[model samples]
Target chain A: MRSLPPLSIFVFALSLLIACSHEQDATAGSPGAVDVTAAWARPSLPPHENSAAFFVVHNRTDHAVQLLGASTSRAGVTELHHMEMDGDRMRMRRVPSFTIPAHGELVLEPGSNHLMFFELPAPWVDGEKVDLHLEFDSLPAVDVLAEVRPL
Target chain B: MKWACLGLLLVSLGCSDSDAGLLDFQGIGGDFTLTDEQGQKFSLAEHRGQVYLLFFGFTHCPDVCPTTLVELQEVFQRLGGAGQDLQILFVSVDPERDTPELLASYLQPFDLPVIGLTGTVSQVEKVAQAYGAFFEKVALDSAAVYTMDHSTRSYLIDGEGKVRYIFRYKDEPERIAQIVRKLLP
Candidate 1:
């Protein structure tokens, strides 16, 4: 029997490590599900301190995942908003739920859909972080850190 | 003698009249170089002869970016022959993810002269800052997970490669078309 070469052994070990790590990532049940990143609260004016948080979410798996609901201690309610333009008028509407398909991406971008946190119990200062409880279907519940920024 | 004097005065006045608009940077467009869809180097000065409508966005911005481009295409089509003298440029704010290949494929849906421009972070910063573009990278603490907050302004460039105006994201293409008519000679 011949002993394996060091180079070949190293390559084989590396590939196995990569595959194992990838598999471990799937244990979260999201397959390749990911929620929005670096989402934060935007400061607002008086009367209506309503502000939106923006982020990016991706689904790495081959199956579709739905974003069912989101909750935050900072506000009384959280909503998924989609900015729409009908004819020449621009408006924002609430969506029942946002969906992310396998190998697909969803962005909570400005001038588009966003996570709206309405009427914060208190105003947020610059550099403050808030905790958000985000719930996803078929994936683990995730806690998000929402940073505060000037309007 | 009177006719000769009048002719000379008119000639001098005509020579002195310059395009004051170009001399002033109205919309404040900065200069940069990035690869075009055809894999050729594209610089602002190279497109000097045409009016340009530039947007800083990523193809991944599913709704806003595509919707704006569609409206812009209609505006260009409305221009008819005037569109010939016009160029619509899409400069991706997410260069790390938006490659030349993706940009090319992404822009195929729009029927206009859509050029995608992207470069390194510093290079993109110079152009974005000059045009008042704002983008912030959101770090999620997860490996390889981040989001970008980019400026949502659509820049308008005149024939001289200078920024002429800026429109809000929701600005109607018809309003833009109205402006295009008076912009060209």
Candidate 2:
């Protein structure tokens, strides 16, 4: 077997290093790297056509991430919303995106940020699971199943 | 002089017995009439003898309002038999959307004894102002079109139809029930 030249060996080693670093970058920023936990949604009652879902998004990466929006088959439209207290008044504002800090978590809980589902085809019965497709700014879309709970 | 002192002591004792541990919100609430979920007139004076949890919110409110209702349901559960004497008056700030039937159906799922109330915009505004509650309609860019930004305080009215305690948002249900229990007969 013939051995390669010194320059060829150097090029091969450089390519291998680049490939390994690219793999690390892909793994670090993958959708699975971000953790979405404690996902749950309130049941929608009839004549009350809307409901909300809450969860905690843990961004394990060193870089911050943005949750742009979410979608579910159960509702006609979904939007990001935040409930804030403006001098004792509860103001529900439509938010464009929510940021999950690096190595930190964003809690979308009751009386805070939430995903509002509007125009529900039917009531979200208890014990059912809502499949949510969450779109992000830098990561691939993450799909989570939120359990419907009666408030 | 001794008789006067004794009479003064008796009056103070009577006052303490009736008003002790309750906050004085004397000028905050009064009698106001609005349309009930049954499409009939409902005046606060009619519920004078009953303890009431008065909350201003709309049915389209997905977060705070529903959570408040659920907390109230827990409050009622904690009250047990006394819960019967405790009534909840849910006044919708969004009068245009929360009609009588919608308000009725919106409350059916909670199972709480709530008298859902809605009326003309001016009527709701009058009652809200009377209780020192504030609300405004904001147009949204989303499919919801409009949402009401309203006060989240739940007024605890005693049997005399006077505001006794104002519960801040997310106040524990147990605490509310304990207070309501004290106001009950």
The best candidate by lDDT is 2
> lDDT tens digits, residues B48-90, model 1?
6678888887754534665677788889878888777777788
TM-score of chain B of each: 0.79, 0.88
Model 1: how far residue B100 lies from native, Å: 0.8
Clashes of each: 3, 0
Pairs with steric clashes in candidate 1: A32-A60, B27-B163, B134-B151
Which residue pairs in model 2 clash with each other?
none
Least accurate 10 contiguous residues by lDDT in model 2 chain A:
A24-33
TM-score for each of the candidates? 0.51, 0.87
- Tens digits of per-residue lDDT, candidate 1, A1-151, equal 9999999999999999998888777666533357567687655323233456767777776778778778788777777767654433334556777888788877776666777766578865568887877677777777878787643
* Candidate that scores best on DockQ: 2
TM-score of 2: 0.87
